[model samples]
Target: MGIVLNQSLKNTIITYIGFGIGGISTIFLFPYILGKTFYGLSNYILSCANVIMPLFAIGMQNTLVKFYSQCKTDEEESRFLSFTVLFPLLLSVPLILIGLLFFDDIAYFLTKKNAIVKDFIWLIPFIGLCMAYFEIFYAWARVHMHSVFGNFIKEVGLRFVSLLGLLAIYFKWITIVEFIYFTAVIYFLAFLVTMLYAFRIKKPVFQFVIPSNVKEILIYTFYIILSGSVANLLLDGDKIMLNQYMAIGNIAFYSVATYIALVISVPSRAMHQIVYPITAKLMHNNQHDELNDLYKKTSINLQIVGGFVMLCIFVNIEQLYEMIPKEYSGGILVVFMIGISKYFDLILGNNNAIIFNTKYYRAVLFLGVLLVLLTVGLNMIFIPIYGILGSAFATLLSITLYSLAKLMFVVKRLHLYPFTAQTLYSIALTIVLFLLFYFWQFPFHPIIAIGLKSILVTISYVYLNYKLVISKEINQVIDNVLKKLKIG
Candidate 1:
């Protein structure tokens, strides 16, 4: 266990550092620079690209992850990489044509505004194409356990480009429409860089040779496509739907709060990039004991980090809103609802890697489809009267329900549960800290109150964790970090 953490430490730390910049960018710059309309457009465009991404790639991102772990020799790895890339190129053809033909209508249907959506409709095909191949390249990176650079590119690179685009909009160098169109272009460039890095390392050959295991590859790819598409819908479908029903600017406000909430998502994603392939390789060998220990440790570690981030956002949300335009204060509910959901999602630990890497993953697809229908239905039922808050509520309920269903499926079928005694203690600490700080509206300035509450609550959380020690593995980690900091 120590060996695994030690090996992943450098890359994981780099990835987190990048995420730290990206987080502040989302929290401070996005709302401040772009405000809500472009914010919504930014969110809307990415959601659009995400929905189309799996379709264009034919779910090769997941396929690469699952299969790459199984490849034996250098030749096998090369052929697999070639097939992954070539297959997505083949799939993108039809998607590109369909995207071009439907551009006008998709824009019209997604928003009633005069060509706001229509103006940038042309960017979707290119964006979709990028999503497909980048994953193929990123999978090449992940298979070698070289995750940090790819992760930085995957999670942070586009945002950096977007920052440039925001500058163009701010300086009037590009109109809002152009800024939106440039988003798709930025993603394409990001993917190209990833491809360059991929070749630099592996020097991928574009030739496809049939593997002895091609049958297994094809079957898993099919399931991955369905599962990936459905999962994307579960995550991004709300933003897309909001673009359709509510004002596009509303997406910006909600996105601010969502961004605050999504800070918790980064550690999970960063850690997962390293952990998934490792877990898959371990599970492939029937190393259930190692896998279980990993599950508990990941939960505690993610919670410890994620919990603090959530508390900071929870306490500072008012100032966060104060700093943003007054119109965004409506997103307070978005903060609470989305923050809790993201926190819970993080606390699930490696449940996702465990599920997606296993044989029963097809079950996740069916459940995901059901989840989409429920989410859409709920959004429809709620959005008419509640507006933006309604959208947040719908998302919160859907994610919560989806998490519960996934948990039950994993437990009943695999007899695994992420929650344990320490899990409850973490939850208890979260509740106590939140109650103390949530409604207090301290006499101090907003920043100081935020700082004090954050420090005090974090201290309380750590002290309580010391008492229960969560998992023994978790206690050891705390002790080690404390020892490094000379806290002990």
Candidate 2:
């Protein structure tokens, strides 16, 4: 718990800083400097890359996390690490070759609705390959329990470099077309940096020998590929569908609004970096009681933190749209729909870790594939009629349904639950705060109004959670901060 708190706090700060840079880029620079068409084109390229990333990496990222702790000796660990790095090439090479052999057909199909995507079609797999390897290396770091440096590179370094690229466009140093190419280079650089950092943590012994658990590892990796694809599809599939059904520019609007809503999930992202590997270790050790305790704590703590973020976003969503261009304002509904779904996910704590690390992962994978189909079906039905709003609706419904299924499987199969009395209290608190502050706004600039309202919300939310002691871990965190300030 101490290490989780310590690193999660650092990761949270780093993630927020990254999201801050990304917010500036997505909310301000991309919209104003590049305009919506180019903005959408860039995001669409990345989204496509994300959607296929799992296939390229072949699930080595998650496989490393799940299986690393089982290695009994340095020799075995090195062999496992070597497999994680090299096995992806087996699939990636063939996939790349296929992409080359069918490049023309693929390009034509992708560009049918939006020809702007035609020229950059090649970058999709190139970037996807880069993204896949980046996660593999990142998982390399996480398995060693050295997640902070890798997290910084993932969260802050990439966005910061991309910010400079955006500025290059602003200064007329690069054309938008060049910036698009630069984006591919940026992902490659991120992979390079993380790989180096991971090597520094534990210099790879590079044993190519297959481990005794090779069969088990292969099976897990296979299922994880589908599972990871399902997750990424749910996250970015809406944008891809938007590219197909709506104007490429609509993705730009969806990107901005979703980015704002995405801030609510930062805590989960930050915590999961460390928590995932920890959960893996716990399950590997067969520490059921301890695992269940972690489940409850993580659930309540994230609920409190994520709830605060959601409250701020919901109350200040209107002003947030005011800060962006009016053309992008239609995504206000997109924000709430996406935000609520993400909040539901956040409260589930380490539910994903529990499922992916368990033997019943195949069952959950089956559910995930079905839900991915459901998401695509919903988008097909709704996108033509409702536009980006429809895509958001599709995402909200799919993610919520998928989350509930995962939650139920974990509880029924494993006899573990993430909810407790504190869960109910936290939910009630979030609702109360939202109703109280949402209608009220400061008569000032949007920035100032958001600042004041956020302060009011934070103070009220923190004070109540502290008083009620909704989570002993959270309360202790508050105590430590107050003690450091000498104000407790």
lDDT of each: 0.77, 0.93
What ranges in model 2 sit over 4 Å off? Answer: none
lDDT of 1 by residue, 1-488 (tens): 65456545655566566666666667667777776777777788778778877877776777787778678888888888888888778767776777668876766786674246666666666676787788778877877767778877876677677777777777879876667778778788888999898888888776778778888878888777777777778678888878767778888877777777777777787778778888888888988878887888888878877887888788778866776678878988888888888888889888888888889988777887888899899888888789878877888888888888778788888777677787877887877888888887767776677777778777877777778766576577678888989864
Give residue 76's lDDT in candidate 2 (0 to 100). 85
**Which lDDT value does model 2 have at 94?**
83
| lDDT digits (tens) for residues 1-488 of candidate 2 | 99999999999999999999998898889999889999999999999999999999999999999988888898888899999998897778888998999999988888888998998899999999999999999999988788899889989999999999999988999998999999999999999999998899889987678888889999998999999999999999999988888889999999998999999999999999999999998999999999999999899999999999999999999988898989998999999999999999999999999999999999989899999999999999999999999999999999999999999999999999899998999999999999999999778999999999999999999999999999998888778888989963
Question: What would the TM-score be for candidate 2 when compared with the true structure?
Answer: 0.99
Instruction: Report the error of model 1 at residue 235, Å.
Output: 1.7
Poorly placed runs, candidate 1 (over 4 Å): 7-20, 168-175, 471-478, 481-488
Model 1 error, position 259 (Å): 0.9
lDDT of candidate 1 at residue 275, scale 0 to 100: 86
Candidate 2 lDDT score at position 4: 95
Model 1: pairs clashing at backbone N, Cα or C within 3 Å: none
Error of 1 at 343 (Å): 1.8
Q: What is the lDDT of candidate 1?
A: 0.77
